[model samples]
Target: MLVWERPEPRNRPVPAPLSRDRIVRAAIRLADADGLDAVSLRKVATALDVRPMRLYGYIDSKEELLDLMVDAAYAEILPVGDDWREVLRSLAESVRHTAHEHEWLADLLGGRPQLGPHALASGERVMAALGELGVDAVMPVTAAVNAYVIGAVRREIAERRAERTTGMDEKRWQASLGPYLRRTIATGRFPALATVVRDAAHLDADDTFRIGLDFLLDGIGARVSK
Candidate 1:
């Protein structure tokens, strides 16, 4: 007897050529265009002209994609010289610049342990620089530096986002609160805050970021020199 007709081929569409790099780049682009919230698998797949299921072939979950994205950002930060202070400053500035370019990056910093290859390499650079300084408890030193960078960048990003949302810069935002602030100051409940706010020269975003970074480095220097 003649062989039965071949069973109907499955109707599944051919998945588009996909790789982890492509998927992560698409996700990063989505996040860069619109904040991190916009980077879901479905949205990324649509952006890449593939089925959402296709992404699972390369990435296990959104969290893994995010980790890769953060690692990609870290990859941009090349290490500097062997001098501990200089190395740390360069690293911090590199991170700040990266955060500025990819606003979503600030959100991911310190959100989880960065165990990715690039992330680990960046961290190793920091530790190696600190190790040269003969710092006691290198882990704490690493934590402190990381905390400073994360906090500084988070504040910077938050302020920029606030300005975007309100259509106002910090000066204007503070002016908007002028009347209430004046009233509160007159009450003498927070004399020091009033004095500083009234008398202090308002630092621009870049200046504020640099000054804070220097202050953090100063603290670390003090510990190292002791």
Candidate 2:
């Protein structure tokens, strides 16, 4: 059963209550500090100063807790612009921004169907913003944008973790690869890619994300215009 479907404990609003909200908040903290892999039910219980078994009263399993965490993160994605293009652009960018703030979020984004209230409300807002479009175009077109956000967030987070693990920022890392890249390119096996590597703007992740999003938004506009 969905966590939201469960009845809240009578003590929910009481001080220091053991409730779903508290549990989710605690779990999100753990995830934020130590990535998703470090967050287990036992760890959350420890964070809350409660016994592991006691958490079962609030959440049935880790999966449920993850759903709650993702929904909680969705709270960070605010309402966007009135125009559908701006709506989708802001929506995508906000998700990317929030994921950066809470890196663990990338692990679950678009990986599951988020039915939690906050997630549903965000979806409703998007749909309302896109009401000018044909009903059929809304889902698929928006889905395309969502897919892009998911992939982009994952890639960004992966690069972040890589930088952390390797103790090198992207610039230095790429520079370190310079010799091998030069040697490989000299072989004339990837002329086009080598040219891009040498001449492309090599924009920061933020610009790259925005540029990719603009491409998607333009595509969406063209699709709707046709």
Candidate 3:
């Protein structure tokens, strides 16, 4: 009897090759490239060279994928340390950077009180920093910090949306504003507004962010302290 050599077993296929982490990362990259509206299970699966059903093995739906993506993005926010003031300052700046880098992130983080795990973890870090400042009640400090971050992010998003809709570059905007603004300034009806406009020809986003951060921090330091 001729012994027939059995064919070598085909390498076991990687079952459910799509993973939660991989899916989230792909979705994030897709969002980064094409904006958040571009993120979908089908899009991610296509990007990963797999069927959309395969994504279900790891993520239940696009909503879950969004939650995961948000958590992953929030992870970039570094934890706070011993110095409460410094920690607050650093955290605020880090958030500003994150918001600017991921313009869609602010819209993803809406007014919902229930935060994703990563966001909650960042909140805890902020709370821990507040604790170091001897804050007895958790609510007030948490409320303050949350309000500050949300407000700043909202403002940034609004400005970005305005820029997108207007289609005018900053230089064009300034040049157009020059003549009209001068006329507006000459009229005494808007004295306060004119003064601010004259003082700052063009409002810079970074300067606005810094000013808002400082104002919020000052308020928190003065009011939250024992």
Candidate 4:
């Protein structure tokens, strides 16, 4: 059973009155500072000034700890409303920003379904905004936007890590590719590719996310009107 579905211990004789919230918060702090692998039951306990075994009263294992972390982070990702387009747009942008803020978020998001309260709340906000579409359509619409958010976040963060590793941002990376691109495009074997190489303005990640999000939202808007 999931840790949230179980009762928290009420009368543990720990030094501090530890709640699940406190434990989860401490764990997230360790993760944010040193990355996810740096977080452990011992590390979280040390942060809380308690024994590692004390955490067992609130959470059972590392997997459960990750679940709590993901759900809690979802609190920052809840959406705002305007039209459905605006609502989902806000959601997508918020999630992207949240994942960037907590870079480890992109890793845990793919592992399990986020059924915790805050995760459910984030979904509810988007789906309710699209409620005009009726029950059947609302779910798929929300799912499509969420799919884009998840995929975009992962790719954005992956590139971010790569940049960090090599100390090269997009422009420098593209500059490195320039020689090979020039040699390949000279043959006139790939006219479409050559034009993009020559003419396309290299957009940064933020602009790419915005433009891609528009594609999904515009398609959904067409369906909503029909």
TM-score of each: 0.87, 0.94, 0.82, 0.92
lDDT of 4 by residue, 102-123 (tens): 9999888756678999998988
Q: Residue 18 CA error for candidate 2 (Å)?
A: 1.1
Clash pairs for candidate 3: none
Question: What is the lDDT, from 0 to 100, of the residue 165 in candidate 4?
Answer: 91
Count of residue pairs whose backbone atoms collide, per candidate? 0, 0, 0, 0
The lDDT for every candidate, in the order shown, is 0.83, 0.89, 0.73, 0.87
Model 2 error, position 107 (Å) = 0.4
User: If the candidates were sorted by their TM-score against the true structure, best first, what order would they fall in?
Assistant: 2, 4, 1, 3
Query: Against the correct fold, how does model 3 do in TM-score?
Result: 0.82
By lDDT, the better pick of 1 and 2 is 2
Cand. 2 TM to true fold: 0.94
Pairs with backbone N, CA or C atoms under 3 Å apart (clashes), candidate 4: none
Give lDDT tens digits, candidate 1, residues 1-226: 1011123223345556677778889999999999999999999999999889877766678888898899999999866975877887888889999999999999888887877789889988888877866767578877777788889899889989998998999679778999998999999999999889889998887788788878888887887777
- Model 1 clash tally? 0
In Å, residue 54's CA in model 4 sits off its true spot by 1.0
Best by lDDT: 2
* Residue range with the least summed lDDT across 10 consecutive positions in model 3: 1-10
Per-residue lDDT over 1-226 for candidate 3, one digit per residue giving the tens place of the 0 to 100 score:
1011122223336653645668888998898877889998899999999888777656666776777777788888876666677778777777767877777778776544446667778878777877765656456766666578768887877767787889876787889888988887798889899878768655477787777778877877877564
Model 2 lDDT per residue over 67-184, tens place: 9999999999976896898889889989988999999999898777899999999998999988898898989988999999999999989988998998999779878998898999
Cα shift from native, residue 198, model 2 (Å):
2.5
Best by TM-score: 2
Q: Candidate 2: which stretches are off by over 4 Å?
A: 12-16
Measured by C-alpha RMSD in angstroms, how accurate is candidate 1? Answer: 8.2
